[model samples]
Target: MQEQANLNRRNFIRISALTGGGLVLGFNYFLTSCSTSQDGGQVIELNAFVKIDTKGRVTIMSPNPEVGQGVKTSLPMLVAEELDVDWKEIKIEQAGLDTVNYKRQVAGGSGSVRESWESFRKVGATARQMLISAAAAAWGVPAAECATENGHVVYKGKKKTYGELVEQAAKLPVPENVAVKPATAFRIIGQRTRNVDNHAIVTGQYKYGIDTKREGMLYATIIRPPAFGMTLESLDDAEAKRSPGVQQVLRFDNKIAVLGRSTWEVMQAAKKVKPQWKEDGTLESTADYTEKLHGILAKKPEDKPRRQDGNIGQAFAKAAKVIELAFDAPFLAHNTMEPMNFFAHVTADGAELYGPIQTPERARGRIAELLKLPEEKISVMMTRMGGGFGRRLMTDFVEEAAMVSRLAGNVPVNVIWSREDDMTGGFYRPMCSYRYKAALNGNNELVAWHHHSAGVSGGGASPDSFPAGAVPNFQVDAHTYKSPVTTAPWRGPTHNYIAFSEQSFLDEIARQAGKDPVALRLELLEQARANPVGKVNYEPDRFAAVIKKAAEIGGWGKSKGENIFQGFAAHFSFASYVAQVAEVEKQADGKLKLKKIYCVVDCGTVVNPSGAETQVEGSIIDGIGHAMYAELTLTNGRPDQSNFHNYRMIRMREAPAVEIHFIQSSVAPTGLGEPCLPPAGAALANAVFAASGVRLLDQPFIKSGLFA
Candidate 1:
């Protein structure tokens, strides 16, 4: 009943109006339909952020968090590109929950630009049509003769900026078929533009999730069980209550929440408030976990088959030469710059939640589940994310805020997770291991390939993705192990591991067969492109293009003298293809120093060059961290490394000088968030082998002596 009611209300609010200059265009977000009359302003959805006021001012409501991924600028660029409005007149606002129109507001997987591109343009095209019709009516000319430029509509010798005709446009009929500019005619896209939020970032006025402040809002800190699956047994809060500014210490069924005047007070009180826990089971060491994973893989196939090819056992037996290698990636934490935080005001009628989150709609449902309230009564306000990576997707922090508010007798509560708590308590990227093998015939031709992967079990659900290559036989399998710690997508998810093993193994094959790695890949790509196999997931030509481009840019066939070494790798994800080459030099002490990195990508159309470059550079920096130093270790179910000091990220001095080049194409824009991450691992590892003759099969390359 509640769901139905909520759905009904959503439908009722789905169509609204935006009013300006006698215009009456319906002003729902992209999904909502708006109509305009010949004379005045149109009503629009309350959640609609991008609306043209009668004054012809462009207002953009950002639905996703902006943690430096340039969503604030790129997303609005899409809308403005179609709207034909003057960019200077645009005003930006962070959007509130009006799930009636927003879709895929969650920003992760580099899906922001790709997913929102079409919808944003639709919104702008609709608005532009309405403004043009109004101007045509006022000038007594055919609407087709009236063209819009710089917020103005001109027909013959007559001209009127949208602002001058908005009153008339408000009354003009909304055109049913709004015309969108073709790529050839694009004026706003494929152009380098500065980040829309740069001013806010420079001035330190950007409102991150942590910057949210409300009158009489009390701060909170949660104390979770130290060990996974543990139940709270007891609490000692007397000392915490005595701490300065500590207002209350509330104990719930599974945890304790400290409420206080300031974040520091909450943090100080949380430290003093000791909580006892009863272990749910015995702890397992990392080695034990590894053994367990192998055992699971060796056992029977339980779920549906992910992928299968010609009989693997028969193919292996027929081969004269077979090679096998194992690879592993340690658990990773998203470690978003801003710790988890949510401010919730729960009252009798409904609830209001404000903070940093990727998916406001998903957060609303999660809040409803935790608070046991109707979804309609809940409104989530998504603010700028300080850095999501993948950490902000989890709603544990939001749930904690609601729990604190519920316990506080309906008073509003702001739950703040200290950096330590967030690092230790949030979901982690699952650790994974891969066992790969390939069989070669007597003629030294590759015949079969197989990959068996195990770990926290996120990948094997779908066999590793590959193009229809020249290989005759292939098989992919997955093994799962139940983990105490919750897991979520970190960067590229499974592709991060698969790319390292597959690409590195391919390199090995090329070396053994006396063929150039790039040449071999190109040969297989030709087969795939000529007669593609069943259910292949990637484009053969695009994949080969990136490889070829990277090779040329890196001077692959050429060599430098003793000190410098080069390696290459390529990967496709988020509907895009990227290839990279790494140049490394060895220090006298046998330490590896990455000198220059070259990358080429074919991600369809470019949205914003500045935004695209930022994401690519950031992805490279992040990948370097994962390859060289980032890892979260567990000791008795508790994370051993809790802060940046212990679990290191790449510092400025360590970042290799990088060159990024894009393929000029007319394909639709694909995801740019994570495409560059996977190849960095293999490229760096391959470079390590070139520099020091070591093929590190595991991650945190430093631990494997790849760096030293």
Candidate 2:
């Protein structure tokens, strides 16, 4: 049957187009890590690498690790959507270790949708178009008259499944230009579909970053220096080796890595290997971090302006009223549900690795650089990520795993980073402070605005929509500090901090001008829409649309029940737009309780209502976690908060009921993963000011006792 299928594929037009493009796709299929099948029978590579047989069964090539974010299911949706296959008949596969065929397998920056959207469509459409051409040639009908549906071609009331035409299609020359379906006629692109891996997740059949099992695999734990930049002096490995189940103790650079039979055994044995180390005093305390940032900000402003508009000094002088507010937001951890972990096996010529990595390409380079091997020799497989939030984007954990495994002499090694290690070992959202000054004319309209932010510069941070100079008379600049702890892209990055400061200041300016906060912003947005001030970075129409949508959906001007106040904010990031209105009540004792949240978005086209909604809800939770109770502070040169017990995520009981609605548009989709974040912080701050007459200037709002 398999031989016949291969022969038929050779004759099919589908094969011609798929293979032609497959060649151009530069898919080096040889790199997929292969091992014996689960039943210990035949050799099989990771199923993520899918292949279609002559029978027209579609195969998927998934590369991104699936965390709860649904890449496992959603990434495949793109392929299936363009293939015109029956959703019920679709068979999904985890992509094998093939770097040539797949790039950007790592899923961070909410980039999976944005990056894969075009690639998957081309792959599917190429195959379908080829199949249609083959059927057209075989039936002696005009190719234009042949339409493909459910993996078949039909013309003049005659139909045949792709399987029947495969042999003939393979014989036809591959068409250079295959017609693609019109967006208006799409059957699956915008429809709601449940996650493909839902059952696996709910039933515990889903393999997470830490769930892989390998033959003769050993577990390893690293005893890192008590502080960053510290060097290992000596270690008594005999004691660790004496422990039952302990395998070997390897020392390298600045630490000792203990490998053992199981995770628990390695962990237990690592505790006994007390290696001495010399601290470089590179560990920074909160005071040091703050002082350094303050000093950086105090420097003479570099004339290299990030943003500028109308003469801000002149506008301030002409203004009737002016208000200034300084706000601060602290450092935060990504705190993804799954800590960093990776499995690796090293051979003399090559290495195979599996982990919950967000940047597989980046990981490949890092591994090759560290292991000193040809890049092609290392195979990095991305598994289902437990949760990235952005932490998995760093390949440090994967590097450690590969190194340990290589030293273990061919035995597969699983390197696990405990929550404590993860919290402290990884980079964090940079700490920041913002200073803003806004002026208003006699008519109570915003006139001039200047915002200056200081702290660790938001260099290479993901949600790069900040420095939101949407006003006619505005100026924005940021100052950064050099610190030992690394910082990766947090959910919204600079937007998270800027929105809180800018929006809160806007609220204050509105109060000083004796105008409603939402109305004040609407006026500014209207100005941005009509005679958009300066060459700002915002899409004025989309920006205005979100505000209008939120107002309509949220009953913006309506009063809340007694003692409740509503705050509103909108921001665009990840190439998409999001706006939110948060309703809050300030308790007598000063507790801020989020009652309800209304979110409006325009992500171009909605792929799945349920999926989009899920993303929105998750973003809200993520944002709320940062706003209410999440922080990673340092004390005495060490991370004061380590695990979930110290650095908290919002629990189910604390999550606000979120309502999400998207504007209708046929435009190409943008992004939904990170756009909703900035506004959550802004809206929450606005609510606090409105409800209690006391403005909560910073994040982890719970610490402010605003709700108390």
Candidate 3:
């Protein structure tokens, strides 16, 4: 019923004439439609974000930024599906930040499609209605008798192309209460469609933010503080200013910008400037931060409980068996393939920003405040991004470009971050640790759950996320330790680090009870289904489906060849459920090799199978790679791992093969960007234990003595 309400929500569409001749339709974020006449001293021109020409060329303006999540292709599929037009007849174009016509333009939180699903559907359906009415009126037939197929209005034995009647459609009254095609009737959707940008991407013609080129633009890079808790006290740019390609050396709050004719030249010139740094606060190392987190978990009465259900203490006292475990994870970097970059041309007239940003509207708002300009004066154009696992959600790079351009008398400039600058710049996935305890009765049935976590910031899930609702007695407490370091959202921020801890700890309970890990999970899930304890967030059947599918695909609990070890994990997030079965081969010398991972996702409808498979593959690679070899440590408040060489990304030779399966359903679509990632670490760690009997309690599994 809720999905129907979302699908049937009414929206206003205004139709007007195109510049030459043809039809154009646009929509407002508001519930009611306004006139085609001018309002608020600006002409919206019928609010037309979609324009169709006399030649049957349909063009759509995709409002969200593309961060390689395939929104550029997937979002358009929604529009084309309802527009009832031949897929080849329509063209997709990226839209700039337009607050008047678009809403929720950010790309983080795996929400591009989940949030915009209804709006895109309405946009296309409204346009389709307008065209059909025009064709019906021309043929002198009742509009009810006419239906659209392949961009044409058909009746009995006659048909008319939409292009032939689009002009007349622009003059008709705007349609009300538009109805969209049902999922079963979809043509363009549920098809194996490749990304529209695939050709350009493969051919190297896609213009990423780092590839931005403007007329007379200066290539700029910045020199940041050496570490956290430090600030630039003084700088002498006498030598740097003398460089042949150096255009200017400017300083802003805590950063120095060196602008030159080219990227390579500015990077080299910036190093020549000498500067003295001063400690603004106490300098701490990785060990200090780790110890602080441990102290919080050990004892912190002042911290309030995040959640509580029943009496965990009483349940533990009555338990015949108890399993306790501690898990730790380190800070991580985004390491986007393309270094952080943005181009800003801030002139007295207005500010123009062009770059790859997950949140273009956010960047525009920040630039407006920085330049002291009206919101309407700023225009932001989004380019394709090489990679942004939540890093691009920060507008710091965009702000620097605007500030640099403003400092240099409104000269156009492109700002780029060096690889080292990106890693040590301080927005890390905060270091954290988890302590879990489960109480089991004499019957070996689970009864209680206790979780205490402490981190530099709140990056993990609260107690209410999962098993909390299944356990009769549960307690959760969270604490934070303040530091000079900054933290922001990483991929699947809450679940990314905690899933490993949560799921692996469940396995520890399974070991203590002498039950199969998958059996224990299914039993608990059945308990939750029969009688949930608290606020339950997921559909039990849907969640269980993925687990069963993945296990079946990986042949869980079946006899295996010698040296083969398998592990299983499942998690739910972002309105999606995922399960993975990871396999590893144990060698004679006591080393383990990752062989393959079987993954299954229930994210409702899969918009594009190709894109969905790619997202799962990428997420698994990212999750396993980070768990196996990635870590960031600090010495004197400065990151010791500066780049890939030291950061230790997963190499091609070490990456495991992934097989994916998605549950086909008629339910409304959800997101795929981050759901499949959270469970990867747990499945891999459990497999490691099965192969080498090494329980990995720490991240960068290699550091946990898995290799030794």
Candidate 4:
């Protein structure tokens, strides 16, 4: 039955001729990420990848936001791959936010490249097929006899530029099925091609959302409540209105917006507009959250188990020894290099929005609903983001821009959040803590595993990760607190804290069992592949392969320089397996210095090796920075750190050298933007323990006086 359905499947390709000279090819594209409209509905978006000009130039339109994940450069390679064109011969453009033409253009979860792999290949292949048919019809030969090579359709001793045949090809009937090239035929792909916008970016010619400008546009800055759980009581904007360059001051919800001629003027004036506020909810602090998290796990309640295997009580009763440990991680701020900013011109007729938003479709839909206008009346465009890092996923800033524009006489407004406003704003990574109790038998083998994870404002840890199926008696329980604070997904949302806590716990368990951590992990992976167990989320062999590769490349357990120690950790997240080995050098004054980080990734086939390496290196550096010195704390419902001065980021002199390796596979690519990030902390924490001989259970090792 499946075979019959496969035989009946057909691709609908829509091809048309350009007005003067050339061809345009579009096809149905559905993102598998479940990315949806403002009403939570997914739509079929048409992707137009190929557009040929009279000069024989092929323009490939990338339909996703570029958030430094290399989607702008990588996604277009898929189209160029099947079109049989060299990388330098094609042009790339960032597609505007038009839901009628693009779907699921969100950049979160690293879904851009993976979701477009097959569909985009079909796009180029379909166009190639149509071009081949046109060439065959003109030459009076079989369509199969004509082949495309380097932007030209060729027959026996005869060839024609794609530009010459596109007009006739546009008139040909769309083919139901087209063949894509095999991995071996790849020319543009697997080549370490530089980012298409590298020159523009380095030359400062690239325009970000913060750089947006329009005629009659007014610069605006929001003055939100100083603290969470607060409400506006009174507003006094007389002074702000009289200030230099200050145009108007408007109040909306619990915040105030100050408009002026420039960002500098508006920012200076916003400070003068004072507003009285009252507490709407309990003012919570980080100390309170930490105490609650640590205190709750004493009971280790299993009321709602996410996954359960054999009888844990019986296994613990029969075990030789039980190891119990607890781990905690602090809340993290996204802190995107470019602060949240959006440009919106809201009039009674229509709305225009442009910004560095990660979720453009959602922004458009939201603006349409907010303004009581039809979706077609609103237009949202995406500019190159300085950095997304999951901060732009939320549409709060986008909504603010639109609302400010609407309330201010439906004028043009460019709402920008200052760095301090961005840091103090909500939607941060939730604070998380974990408790693990594992029972080991006489043979130093894991018998039972019980883990309970707690988080503020809900989830940051996964209950269905590794070691679930590798053990006989395993159970995962979780508890979440409903706090007034807002929490959102940050990078590998589920695995971010889970991997660190769980992997570190696993390392501790191995040490307690007098076994090598890597060897024990392999043993469990082998059991996962061979023995009876509960549900497993990762492929055992693939997971094991990365670990082995990291060990080989990093020289795990090998000799190193004086005062140098190594740590190992592996995790699977976003459908990718990653293993990292961190090397640390212990200073004479009981400090830890990063020596290097070795990362091995099994994200299937890498689309762009250069970009892929940058992602891995970035994740390592980011994870290391956070683990070493970065921390975000709250005091009486207010963030303690406002900017880089107070919030300690890793410095350039402290940046460690990194080595990255990827497993070569013919499978479709999985997530790469975030998978490598989760394991960095895990490996770093373990390496800290190895170097300092201290079992670190909490994050921000620098604050713990372990790292300088």
Write model 1 residue lDDT over 1-708, tens digit each, in one string.
Answer: 011111111222222234333332223334444433223444344555456655666676667666667887888888888878767777776667776656667777777787776667766776787678877777778887788887878888788777677665545444554556799877778889888778878999877778777888899888888766678888889999999998889987588999988999988889998788898886655666667776766665566556676666788899988988877778888888888999999987679988888767788898798778999999888777787777777777887888788888888888988888888888888888777788888877777777777777355333646532456677777766887777887877777667777888888877777778788788777866786545667888888899999999999979776888888888878899999999999888878888888999999999898889988978887887788888888777778888998988888888998899999988779988888888887888888887777878887887865564
- Give the runs in model 4 whose Cα sits over 4 Å from its true position: 1-20, 31-47, 300-302
What are the Cα lDDT values of the candidates? 0.76, 0.71, 0.84, 0.84
Q: Which ten residues in a row have the lowest lDDT in candidate 3?
A: 34-43
Look at candidate 3 and tell me the lDDT of residue 170.
68
**Can you tell me which runs of candidate 1 are displaced by over 4 Å?**
1-30, 35-45, 297-304, 460-464, 467-470, 706-708
Tens digit of per-residue lDDT, candidate 4, span 282-312: 8889999998888877775857787789988
Candidate 2 segments whose C-alpha is farther than 4 A from its true place: 1-51, 96-99, 441-444, 456-469, 586-591
Residue-level lDDT of model 2, residues 129-183, one tens digit each, is 6678877877888887888788778898989886666545445554443345678
Candidate 3 lDDT at 116 equals: 65
Note the residue pairs that clash in candidate 3. Answer: 26-47
lDDT per residue (tens digit) for residues 1-708 in model 3? 132222222444443543436565664333323222222112334232666766667776677878888988888888889888888767888877777776667888888888767767777887788788988888899989888888888989889887787777767777666777888898987888888888988999888889888899999999999899999999999999998799899999899999999999999999899989999988999999888888877874356678888898899999999889998889999999998999999999799999999988888888888889988898888898888899899899999999999999899999999999999984889888888989999899999999988888554546666686789998888877888888888998878988889999888889889999988888888888998998778887888888889989999988679889999999988999999999988777877888899999999888888998999999999999999899999999898999888999998988899999999998878989999899998999999888877788999988765552
Winner on TM-score (1 vs 2):
1
Candidate 3 TM-score to native = 0.95
